[model samples]
Target: MNEAKKNSHMVGTVSELSVMLEYAKRGYTINLPTTPARYDFIAEKDGRSVKVQVKHGSTFNGERELLGFSKTPYNKRDVDVIAMFDSNDGTIYYIPTDHVEGMTSIRLRIEPYLYSVKSEKALIAEHYKKFIG
Candidate 1:
């Protein structure tokens, strides 16, 4: 494989491992599917299962953390939650599928000073923190 593809795969694998660790730390049982699945893995707790799709968060234009979902169309039926790990901040953001059902990409500000007031209003970092669990 080319260097870029190899690097991307490595980042994705690391992000998935990070998400699995986070779920395990929260007392959830991690289950890996034996067959092809839409979501990456399932986190089960109290008999409830949450389908998770993990994406490696990357910096865009050296400012915002960009989470791209171009591999597939956003389908709420495919997964319950989307876990994005920001390598820059070492932080993970858990976003429900419903919130981003039809979106192709999500941009998050890693540094406050890099965003404008108008864009900042809609990209408040605090809004996504509550869903970290």
Candidate 2:
């Protein structure tokens, strides 16, 4: 029986969209480039700019989340910082862009996750998924 194909696009809209918005709320300049592209947004804050491959776990749950955080060997292009985030609860875990072996849609990369920021603006919110680091 053809169980109705689950609509993936709708979920991506909810999750990835939330991730982008949360980044902006925290004062990083945000950008959404044309789709069918390499990454989702470019976030610049504290004099740093990054090519973020934003992932919506519920967004593209066909295993792309695994693509983002696989702790394996990879080429140098993956060195620009990568992130796997759960925006709903405002928690994102990231690492150097080259940690994972392969590439896929979703997995994001942002740098300098740890630093001394103004106490009032620290990203101390909670997230659901046990995000990658």
- Which candidate tops lDDT? 1
lDDT of 1 by residue, 1-133 (tens): 9999999899989899988998999999999999999899999888889999887777775555455554666678998888878877668877777877777676665555543444632344445665433
As for candidate 2, its clashing pairs are 53-108, 78-97, 78-98, 81-109, 82-109, 83-108, 83-109
What TM-score against the true fold does each predicted structure earn? Answer: 0.84, 0.50
How many angstroms is residue 95 displaced in model 2 relative to the true structure, after the best TM-score fit? 4.0
lDDT of each: 0.75, 0.47
Model 1: number of clashes?
0
Q: Give candidate 1's error at residue 90 in angstroms.
A: 1.4
Angstrom error at residue 59, model 1? 0.7
The 10 consecutive residues of candidate 1 with the worst lDDT sum are 114-123
